[model samples]
Target: MPAGPVRTRDEVVTALRDSAGVGMGYVPLGAAFGILLVTSGLEWWWAPIFSVVIYAGSMEFLAISLVTGGVGLAQVAATTFFVNFRHVFYGLSFPLLKVRSPIGRLYGVHALTDEAYALLATRPHAQLTGPQVLATQILCHLYWLTGSTLGALLGAGVGLDVEGLGFALTALFVVLTIDAYRSAPDVGTLVLALGCAALALAFVPGGMLVAALTAFLFVLLGRYTLRRRRVA
Candidate 1:
């Protein structure tokens, strides 16, 4: 028999207790998102709407520019797919957990943020349970929705501190970069990622992602070529 499922509390305090430290992280990130949304010309209501409807923070940011620049849906969708391609990998690790319902799977996709993944990934594999996962996802979405709306609402009153708030997204990217580099045991891969970042900084204008992906492929090819030569 499967080790039975865990239960989620039906209220806020329980959700907070379950979420632990992740809530603190979500607050500021959510605030920054709200500010970004308001500054980008989205109506205050749209802040919460997108936060709920799209729910992909980075993609939401990208969407703002896409909307303002008059980019079509096709281009916007392509960028979003490229940017979030890594989420596909998240599915691999937690693919067959205890999610037993269609709605749970639906919520699962909606709640698949970087923070949520990190939190759940730490659990002992078999020890993980359905309700706990749902709780984490629900709480995260709520926090994001609330924080984002608050920021946008506040923006209408007093406006955003542009310089300071812009750093929020930059900080997120830096943290992600550090985490990714730390994952590869080989220093060479780290160096390659950094070099690619620098090259993007130099040559790619609004094309940083394209550069990064290219660099990743280039590094892989170089590694393969070296191995093939040695074998030959």
Candidate 2:
């Protein structure tokens, strides 16, 4: 069989729109993040710098407070690990390992924001050629970079409307959570969420992200125990 056409302008454009479709909310959120970074003590240009280089959404936000506080490197490293070690799970959840090259693999890994991961994974696997995957990741990256840079450059003009933009990510996550619960039949998951929420309310420092991860871990452990019981 002839190899599928190398990603052309048309495919790239489609990927851009597809990627950017998911990024629509991200743009405003990223811009708001930029504003927060600027307000918190980061130099204006650092907004774009971190967004482009770190490419980790929540990490950038955390770093803002950390920087202002003069947090030590070890503390920052520890924080990044606890907060984003979940990316480690992405390797298991990833469905696109088969088609990509080493370079594409690296790029995809770097681009794995929560929004991008969901958008990319839920896509039909066959639909994404390497070029398409690269295109999608690039679009998402550029969206963050552009949004951050714009907000940083124009921080003086930012107004209250930005708070609504920041809520877009929360709203998007809410929709995803509702969808998960709607179709889920697992009793363990519901229990785990409640348990984690309780633990999170009591202990976790980073807030919602940590709480959600804790909840997910509870569900995983519960499911594993149930499976073992069935097997034994």
Candidate 3:
């Protein structure tokens, strides 16, 4: 793929400005996570620690329960691996090459959340630069950090009733699913997903998500095999 022209700091600034609208959404969601963390019986400071360290949006929410429940590290590690396994595929085509320096590319990989990846994917590769990509990712991270910090403070100070905040992650996923379906508009994929979900629910209710994803992987593999055979 062709690289965009080398951009100056001003271009990076413009990219940040363009992303500002979408980045704003992160703040409230991050704040919700913060509230949940505090209410889950953790210190307010844990909000920033999770935001900066774990940085896994929905998984961080799950982490609250995991920590509270005293789940073992092995389970947490395995769960995290399965939950975030999709990122392996994201890196395959992500514009990591556009990042000029090694350090920038490292950060780019670390910051490649669903939002950043979706925003970057929308732009033409030829129009994107290292700095612009980095700027968008950094801006999104900052938004989350700021929101979570504020939420933690609010929770600690006022003790707001935030029991409903847990639904925020579910709502976010539903929105993402709708956007994905609209973008692809594939009935076969939808059918396969539904089938997987049903099977997982029936056989592995406790690990439905992992089970469904595993089944989907098999379906995809079979499809790929048939395609390759036909091509040959």
Candidate 4:
């Protein structure tokens, strides 16, 4: 079958094959989110709904608890913003511009999951065609959808301890973090991140994640500005 307009069969196959690694990670992680959501008292159908609509990896897991616990809109918004604050940095390197069409670009941005970002980021940006990028993302999304659906169906039939399930995303992040550091080791950036975390932990223990992310963002912006000035 044709992958999409302007894409060859070989390219489509390659994209699908490349996305298989992402699928491997996403399936289990998505399943964990699915199992946690259902076990937390949400309907099995809600699993697919969340996977389709939200698609925010770690945040989706947190949303299950927030939704079940009857969190207010304000709290949910604040929590979501803080939890996903790191995504802002993702846009800096994401190949969003490679996607030619407006609709494809829109979906590309929406479907830019951590797995997709990691997979695509490893590839040379100029080497990727719009269809290849979109196809890979779509395949990853399908993997997540399939996993979540199956997991929700299974959770409905049997009881399981979901406490450990939450670690799936964490483990994925750890692996990704290691891969990122190995690819481009930077002591200054590592030290900055650690310093931010330390300051957050010391000053705002209850809001450490938010404080750390906010501080890191500002520090990154400052660094970028300084580098730009030096370049000019």
**All candidates' TM-scores?**
0.69, 0.74, 0.75, 0.82
Cα TM-score of candidate 1? 0.69
lDDT of 3: 0.80
How should the candidates be ordered by TM-score, best one leading?
4, 3, 2, 1
Query: lDDT per prediction?
Result: 0.72, 0.73, 0.80, 0.83
Error of 2 at 19 (Å): 2.3
RMSD (Cα, Å) of model 3: 4.2
**In model 1, which runs have C-alpha deviations exceeding 4 angstroms?**
1-7, 10-15, 166-232
- Please write out the lDDT profile of model 2 over residues 1-232, one tens digit for every residue: 3345533676788887766555776678788888887777567889888987788877887888898999999999999987788787665666557435888788788887776666566556666666776777788888888888777767745532355666677786666555546654556666776777777777874585566675676678788899999999
Cα displacement (angstroms), candidate 2, residue 102, comes to 1.6
Weakest ten-residue segment in model 4 by summed lDDT: 1-10
**lDDT per residue as tens, model 4, 66-183:** 8999999999999988877767777788888888899999999889888788877766788887778888889989999988888888888785555666666667767877777787
Off by over 4 Å in 4: 1-7, 224-232
Residue pairs clashing, model 4: none
Worst 10 contiguous positions by lDDT, candidate 3: 1-10
User: Distance (Å) between predicted and true CA of 14, model 1?
Assistant: 7.2
Candidates sorted by lDDT, best first:
4, 3, 2, 1
lDDT of 1 by residue, 1-232 (tens): 3333223443334546756555555667777777777878778888888888888878877777887799988998788888887677567666336677888988898789876776565455576667767777888888778878888888777887645654554565555445544553568876787788788878885777666766777777898899999999
Worst 10 residues of 1 by lDDT: 2-11
The predicted structure with the larger TM-score, 3 or 4, is 4
